[model samples]
Target: MAKTQYYTATSIDGYIADANNSLDWLFEVDEGTANPFGEFFAGVGAFAMGATTYEWVLENDNLLEEPQNWHDMYGEVPCWVFTHRDLPPVPDANVFMISGDVRRVHEAMLVAAQGKNVWLAGGGDLVAQFAQQGLLDEIILGIAPAVLGEGTPLLRHKLHVDELILTGVREVGQFAYLTYAVGDVARMGRHLAAETATLLPVNF
Candidate 1:
């Protein structure tokens, strides 16, 4: 079955980007020869990203000038970018710019993905939006051996311990990779309600 997954790298302190919204620190990490992103991307037939992430890629990779780079990386796979402002698209790349209602966009992504998984390439806020709607299925985090005092978090929303099951763990060079299976939101809500009831005062 195709699942919605968030795969991204973060600092040791759980920051995806620095206070300046820069990922230069991540690029400095030595991935060695065990990087798993290739394998992960192969299973992703379609992907989505926030405006910030898309802009970063555009700037760093020079997608506007050298559009072939985008093609070389993703081939014909479709990509949906969530943005409120007008942003230039990469020539010849399968990119869709849209905004509002992640649920609706998620449905489109599922269809575009065919039988493969959908990747949520994101800024923390964007991923949180999907999580809040119970649209996220899994989280794969690559923790780099660095820390940023303040910056963009891995996820802006709260994920209770009971809502995540650790499925895998591995070390790749200076990075620690962790995979988690997201639990059903309805079950988690019920658990929270029960816990809250128990904590309430019982007055005669």
Candidate 2:
């Protein structure tokens, strides 16, 4: 059973990227040596991201000029870029440009992931689309000690109290790592009413 998880780093104000859609601010913060990214990435057989995120990585890393660099980050792990336009592929990187029903892509991602987990690399809206389809299972965020008044949002869906369960939290230097298990929103209200719990903070 491969679970679909949205793993991302965000500003304290819930922005994944700055107004320019750049991560320069995020680079300023030190997330500490002991981070959970490595452990989580080890189980991700496949990842999917929106065009903006994919393009940003491709440009920032110079994947086209230094093609091999792409492998160093993601190896042979398959990557799906949800886009409507054609995009150039980086030499040997296992990347694909696709657009259509997210459910269909999710099924493909699961198959490609084998028994491993499916990672939802983000641009916010794309991940929300998955959440709405009930294809998203978990959310992991590393909250940096910074804020971008307006930028790329962390998530675009209206998930209420019962929609998430706080599974874990870790304070790593200036960053706060949080993990939440996503539940069925339709049945979430009922569950929360029974438990008498408040909704988790949507800071990031």
Candidate 3:
């Protein structure tokens, strides 16, 4: 079955980017001979990203001056960028700028993905919305050896330990890769509701 996955790198301190919103620290890490991202991305027929992530890639990769970079990385896979503002598109790339509910976009992504999995290329907050909606199924994190005192978080939402099942763990150079299978949304909702009920004050 096709699963919705959030695959991204993070610092040891659980930040994706530094205070400056820069990923320069990530590139400084020693990547082993084998990069597993290509393999993971192969199964992704469609992907979505928040405006910040999209803009970062666009500017950092110089996708405007060199649109081929986008092709080389993602190929012809459709990308939906969640942004309310007007952002320039990469030439010759299947990029869509959209806003509003993630549920509708998720449906479109599923249809576009066909039998393939959907990837959530995120900026934390965006992925949290998907998780809240029960659209996110898996989380793959490449934990790098770095600590940013304050920066963009890995995920904006609070996920209980019981909600995640560790499926795989591997070490690649200085990075530790961890794969987690998220619990179903329905069950998660029930758990959250139960917790909320416990927190409610009882009448004297």
Candidate 4:
């Protein structure tokens, strides 16, 4: 089964991005310290993000030109960008733009994932939509020390009760990274053996 996961950084107040949808706050990380997110980043097989995040990465950094070692690993992995407006494609072979129903985009992502993990690369609105539909399988958040008074929240809506289980936590400098696994929804179904056991009278 394909598991969908989100890897994002949040402010102390739980904002993932600023009002302008910028991640300027995230760039303040201590360069000397080891990154706690390396493990999670290594595990992702594919990345999915909204158009805005994709555009920001390309324009802000010469990311498209100067390829880093991270690209050596992530470059081969498919990057699906959700966009309504058409834009020039990334020069790399791994990046692709998708415009369609969110559900369809997700389905295509799963197919492309091919048993590998699918990463939700930020954009709370997109993440919320997947969570609402019970399609999101995991959430991994890196909480930065700074707080933004107002910005884009980590999640926009309430999910089903007991829907998440914390798997691990790591501290890197002033930031704390947390990982959660989505509870299984299919477990709610009753099996034939369980039904038969329920029907049988209790032994006196």
The residue-by-residue lDDT of candidate 1 on 1-204, one tens digit each, is: 788999999998999999999999998999989749888999999999999999999999999999999998899999999999999999989999999999999999999999999999998999999999999989999999998989999999999888887778999988899998785843565577799999999999
**Of 1 and 4, which scores higher on lDDT?**
1
Cα RMSD (angstroms) for every candidate in the order listed: 6.4, 5.9, 7.3, 5.2
What is candidate 4's local distance difference test score? 0.75
Q: Residues 49-120, candidate 4: write the lDDT tens digits.
A: 887777777777656575463375465778888888886665655888876666777787787777778899
Question: Which stretches of model 4 miss by more than 4 angstroms?
Answer: 64-73, 183-204
Off by over 4 Å in 3: 185-204
Model 2 CA lDDT for position 19: 89
Q: What are the runs in model 2 whose C-alpha is more than 4 Å off?
A: 185-204
Sort every candidate by lDDT, greatest first: 3, 1, 2, 4
The RMSD (Cα, Å) of candidate 1 is: 6.4
What is the overall TM-score of model 1 with all chains considered together?
A: 0.90
TM-score of 4: 0.80
lDDT of model 3 at position 150: 95
Query: Deviation in angstroms for 155 in model 1?
Result: 0.6
Better of 3 and 4 by TM-score: 3
Which candidate achieves the best lDDT against the true structure?
Answer: 3
